[model samples]
Target: MNAAQIHPLARSPLQSGIGASEPDPDAIVASGVHVIDVETRALQALRPRIGAAFVAACRRMLECRGRVVCTGMGKSGHIARKVAATLASTGTPSFYVHPGEASHGDLGMITDIDVVLALSNSGETEELLTIVPVLKRQGTALIAMTGRPESTLATLADLHLDVSVPEEACPLGLAPTSSTTAALVMGDALAIALLDARGFTSEDFARSHPAGSLGRRLLLHIADIMHSGDGIPRVGADATLSEALVEMSRKRLGMTAVVDDDDRLLGVFTDGDLRRALDEGTDDVRTTPVLASMGRNPKTIGADKLAIEAAHLMEEFKINALIVVDAQQRVVGALNIHDLLRARVV
Candidate 1:
């Protein structure tokens, strides 16, 4: 572009601090503060505008049997993509389709049962306007978000959400700043509103994000990771301490459950208990009964509890392992801190 086309704020290489004096720190801070203040005001202005039109837009999306197709051009397109992701992850099915691509056959991705949410700061984005006629013919619902209520795109929309901003944060008044922030915040409001209306819970959100930390905490149960069957270290209450140590070594869980003939848990014999016995010098491992050194009423968890709950219990008690018991207090499984770490639940 020529010099006339260049933005007033654009600086040539030589003017951009190549061996030039350092910029004033106070000026830089003031500029940042001004930008934040402008965006904050934009959001404040957007709040009251979420009335009838916003409600109608949300209603259209919620009733959509297909999906919410978000479309826009330029910087507005970036906001549309993010809004689409937020809507999708928060329970509403949505996706972003670039306006330019929509005009080039990507519009086929949209169906009549779907709602199209189009964004344009000026409400005159050519690419978005070009596809409106086709969308209209297809009987698709249109929700327009723009700064100008009188613009052609707004006039054609079934619902118009006014995102008018008082002023842009950019000093040059050419770049999208406060306008984009208003659009993004408005999108979030719609998504979260629909999320609540749909009774979307954290577990529902976790189902969509199974690979994330929140998913691991909410969906991973103790039974999913606990070692059951032969993996559980256990010995009869009548067994010697030496036999208990052998079970603990073979299972490698740092502990063995002392059980009765019916396999009902009596107590747990851990490495810590053995160390305490050695320090006290009271009994020999080869001759002493496992019950003598075992800790009674040890911390136990149900196999159905969330893995995160186990972590909390372990941290609260300062223990490294826990015996998994069933509803009848029978030893069913075992797990350690390392198992939780391996599952990335901690």
Candidate 2:
């Protein structure tokens, strides 16, 4: 069909003139739909093929008392890096090794304590095979992800994860598109399985990624962000409203805890309190005790509670801060939304 008439294969079905030249909209739509179909088939085919071999691979890597050494070449090398990252961030310790570099001096990095996961679509990457014999001699467990089961890499591996497809999604049957995606997803499956097998928690994940946002959400304790000891904006119930405001300013937490003579949390007075008090002509009334203007039973969380919970309190109450207290109801610390922001949980 002509571009004007439009067919499924036509490059431009609706040629329009805004001010100038016409464009081929049909061809773009056809090419895009074709690409989506190809990718969807590649992904859907993995369902039935995820057999016992995947589980065995996970068990091998989980039982491996050492690191996971991921090796591959070209596009596979990029996927290898992601696999290594997923392994490390989950429960297993893993690192990527270029197949070419392993042939030179990097092969020394592998040991019997490690497990090797090699990726090659053809299963015949020469650099990868060059070191297989040495690894076998060292007794390192080997896992292969390849399309060709009869290929050399598959024959040498202790566990073979068949990532084969009838053909690659590449229209010409040449590019590595579909195979690489399948191998990468399989690597993710292995990483997550090992993570579950190890009972890896978010806390464990955060420990490994201490600089990431999850680390701050899970690891930054109340004590990490709380204003402690003299830095806490606290004043006695007998103190005047003006005195509490001074304390709030000095601590910069926007509120002051009103406590009993024994340092027990009695209530909290904030700038909001100051405004309310002034509306009743208490601004000039310095004689009013801070407790008289305080919010009795102000929201509180434990010093041991997660900072994420603290962020939640601030969001739920539509306030900026909260009191940190011990089991005895003694004010131990304080934190504001800004603290959570600095910690990256906000």
Candidate 3:
């Protein structure tokens, strides 16, 4: 087949308006720098606009009994979706509804107690306007983020947040570049303000993100991951150093807790203690009592303490293992650095 028949729509570099030459690295860098500078100025202009209207929007969301329903069209829709996710992940309860979809049947997702945050660069998106009447009839509060103050969407809103940018970062001045960034930043500001108002803590954040690394670090307790019962390496205070070594090897914890007759933690014998004992030319391991070589006043953690706390204790003292104790200081469990590593709590 001829070249044209084989590739029906393919064009030469010149036909594609890209000259048959490599692009200039310096020119590409300059374009990127210009875009960043434009977007930076847009964010700076948006800062002062966050006064009364911004605070009012925050108050409406903070007092909302239902979710903050974010809706927009085109690029604004993308920003709205991200804003919804941010709000949900923070302290505020929120979700996104497409304005175009809302015009169909997604409007049912909104309720009278909800606060709708609508975004439009020109404040004149037809899809958003089509649902405004229904939202009003239902008594849902409206918050508009727009570039034009007098436009239909802005004027229709109970409160307006102006995300107007001086110009677009796009060289053609036709793309939603700086405008989208401004809207996203405004949404973040609202979510974080509500987060602070609700006194959201890291633990609360962890509860919502249990599958993430931060959740494992913050929510995992010693009782959840520590080796307990037969899994814990332990020996009586009267056990020989050789017996303690055998217990440590069998449990593979690199250490063994030294317990009293009633199973109360007396001390711990670890690889480090063994090294010190050998370096000091202590008595034979088969005959010497483990108590003579065990570390006294060893660090211990409660079963209810966070796993990350155990990691901190290990690091603070340069120790690799910890004894888990009950309220009466009885040895209930044991864990080492490897335990935290396996659970990814470290």
Cα lDDT of model 3 by residue, 118-217, tens digit: 9999999999999999999999999999999999999999999999999888866788999999999999999899999999999999999998999999
User: lDDT of each model, Cα atoms only?
Assistant: 0.92, 0.85, 0.91
- Sorting all predicted structures by lDDT, with the top scorer first, yields 1, 3, 2
Candidate 1 TM-score, true structure as reference: 0.94
Cα deviation in Å at residue 314, candidate 3?
1.7
Q: Quick one: RMSD of model 1?
A: 4.0
TM-score of each: 0.94, 0.91, 0.92
Steric clash pairs (candidate 2): 11-26, 11-27, 12-26
Better of 1 and 2 by TM-score: 1
| Steric clash pairs (candidate 1) | none
The clash count of every prediction, one per candidate, is 0, 3, 0
Considering summed lDDT, which 10 consecutive residues are worst modelled in model 1?
4-13
- Please rank every candidate by TM-score, starting with the best: 1, 3, 2
lDDT winner: 1
